[model samples]
Each structure stands twice: as C-alpha cells, then as structure tokens.
Target: MFNKKHYKFNLNSTFAKLLGSYLIIISLILTTSSLVFFRKYEKLIVTQEYNLSEKLLNQANYYVDFNIQWATSFLYSLYLDEDIYDLMFSQSSHYKKNGISKLKHLNLSSSNIDSIFIYNKFDDKFYSSLGSPAENYYLPSMKNIIYKSKNTFTDAFIPSQIKINLKNNNITKNIISIAILTSKSSEKSLSSAVILNLNANTFSNYFKHNITNNSNLFVMDNNGT
Candidate 1:
C-alpha cells in the first residue's frame, strides 16, 4: 500500500520555499532591467559625440575654404597691379626694392599671413615678405615639383627656414608654405605662394570655443592618406 500520510505537504515549509523562489525571480528581473538602462545611456552618449564631431568637421572645412579664397583674391589683385608689373618688366633695381617693401607691409597686415612670395619669371628672381632676395627662393628647375590636383588640397608643407635674421642671434623660423600655379588667359604663367604660420594654441582655442565637447573632434583630408 502507498504511504499517503508521509507524502502529505507541510503548509508552512512549502510556503517558505515558494516565497524564496519568488524573491530570486524578482532579483533576476531587476538586474536585467538595470543592465538594459545602462546600455541605452551609453549608446545615447556615443551618438551625441558622433553628431558633434560631424558638425565641427563641416565648420573647419568652411573656414579653410574661406581662407584659400581670400588668398587667391589677394594674389589676383597683386598680379593686376600696374606698379608690380612695371617693377618686374623694367628690371629696375630701385623699383624692385620699393615693391618688395610694399608687398611685405601688405602681407603683414593680412590675418593668418606668415609670408608672401612673388616669383618674377622675367628676371627669374623671387620677392618675399622677408625683404631682399628671398632666402627660401625656389629656383626655376624646382618649378612644378608638386602635382596639380584641382580636387585635393595638398598636405601642409613646413619650410625649414623661411626667414633667418643673422643680426637677431641667427634666429630661424619655420613656416607653413602653400603654393598655387596661375595661368592667364593670354598664356602667361605665374606662380604665387603663400605661407601661413598657424598659431596652434590660438587655433585650438578657437576650436574649443566653437565645439561644446572637443574631445571627439578630429580633422582629416580628402585622400584619407
């Protein structure tokens, strides 16, 4: 015969076991909910950062383009100046001296302009903001060394010594040099170069001001090279 009495349920002990199981289930549910909330918060932060980075990059591009356009306009004005042409064509030493000084003064006044160089194809001479015969002159043989790409802005090139003042304890300064080749409708060719010594600290400060969280901001060129 089956032992029905021994198998009978104990009400208090059974209730205690049921209650323990319910508590464990509740703990697991709470843990899962917390984990889900944390993950959602993390994803939101990442998305915000990405959006901010994109906005900054777009602003930087605009700034760079504006700078380039400003430089090109200045160069065109210089090229069209009758005085500049008279100096170059006449081969007059006096005119060259005065013209160089004028160019230097003009260059110094422009914001972000480190130096400016004008290469006279007529005399094969170079004039720069540094005053006399440009120390960093590019010879005729070195012309067109860089590739011409209308779609890309070339990488930044730093000249070892753009200006050296022997009188000032032989101080040498590095400059960020950029060049553009120009051709007139009349088949006349002229090369104009601009050097800008970027103030890194000032630039970084400007970026910080424009960007809310600059930690995620990064800059890269078109080539991704």
Candidate 2:
C-alpha cells in the first residue's frame, strides 16, 4: 500500500495537470474564435470593395453613353444646317468661313464644349477653333472608322496619352476620346465625322471609391492594349 503522504502528493500533481489542460483548451477556443471573426470581417470588406468597383464601372459606362448621345445630337443639328451642306457642295472659301463661324458661335454658347470643327474630305479643308487650316488634317484610321460605321453614334476611342497641369500641384494624366458619324445624306452622298474629347479625370474618379489598401482595378476594351 502507498504511504498517505505519497498518495496526497500524487493527487495534487494530477490536479495541477488537469488545470493546465483546461487552460490550454481555453486558449485554443479563444484563438479559433478570433480567427473566425477576422475571416468574416475580411469577407465583408471584400464584398464592399467588389460592389464599389462594379458601381464605378457602371458609372463610367453611363458617362460614355451620355457623351456619345450628346455628340450625336450635336452632329444631327450640324447636319441640319443648310450652311454646312452649301459649304460642302460649293467648296467656296466664303461659304466655308461662314459655316465655321456658325460652328464657333455654337461652341461659345455651350459650356461643356471646348471646341468644334468640320473636316471636308472632298475639298481637303479643316475648319476649327484652333484657326490652323490644314489641307489634309484627316487621319486615315479615323477615316476608316467613319467609313466602316453607318450608325449615328460610334464607340469610345481613347487616346494613349493625356497630360494635365494643375496649379500648385503635380501634373496628372489620363486617356479619353470619342467619335460620332453624321449622315449628311441618306443615300450615302455625304457624311461627316465628329471627334470629341472627354474629361478623363471625371471618368476615372468614379473608381476612387473602389480603391482599397491592397486591391487593384483597371478597364480594357477589345483591343486589349
């Protein structure tokens, strides 16, 4: 038979061992709970970011459509102008100046429009607010685009470079462009293209809400360049 003192010592040792095991189990439970809570928080954050990104993409698409519609309307009105038709058919310098003057007046009336110009492919004349007359200002790529599309509105065509200068701040940059085709004649007798410059910053700022500490976002078209 074991001594009574020895028996008491064994009981005390066993109690200490049980207490240690309980402490370990409690620690494991706390750690598991903390991990689960963190995972849920991370998931919530991811969902919010995704929603924000989708909203931004929608906003961008909306602006693109809005600008295209505006351009279409502008071109439609221009096509209705008798002066433009007369200028195109006559190929006379006087009529051309008159048409350009009317366009300048229209540009001045609208706040959103920075400038407006007409390019006559038949006569190879360019009339614009810039006052730089060129015998041939038409880009072949643009010409091909206008030729292939017979619709009233065209898709967005962004340029590769955009440089912006802000006072007391660093320079910023972005890319945005659009083109619209005006049907001067239903019988394919006459047509003119309208090129529009959109505010890239305005378009890009829609995605600002989607930005997170470690996330990235971007947009691309079919060209994938």
lDDT of 1 by residue, 1-225 (tens): 886665756657978789888999999999999999999999999999889877878788887567656655665566566655554455678777667777668777755665565556567566666654344443331233222323122344333343345555554444444544333212244433322333234344556788765266554457552
The candidate maximizing lDDT is: 2
Deviation (Å) of 196 in candidate 1: 8.1
Instruction: Give the per-residue lDDT of model 2 (tens digit) for 15-79.
Output: 88898899999999999999999999999999997998688678766765676577667766766
TM per prediction: 0.65, 0.62
Which candidate should be chosen as best, given TM-score against the real structure?
A: 1
Q: The CA-based lDDT of model 2 is what?
A: 0.57
Against the reference, the lDDT scores of all candidates come to 0.55, 0.57
Q: Which stretches of candidate 2 lie over 4 Å from their true place?
A: 1-12, 109-114, 133-225
Candidate 1 error regions (>4 Å):
1-12, 132-165, 168-172, 180-220, 223-225
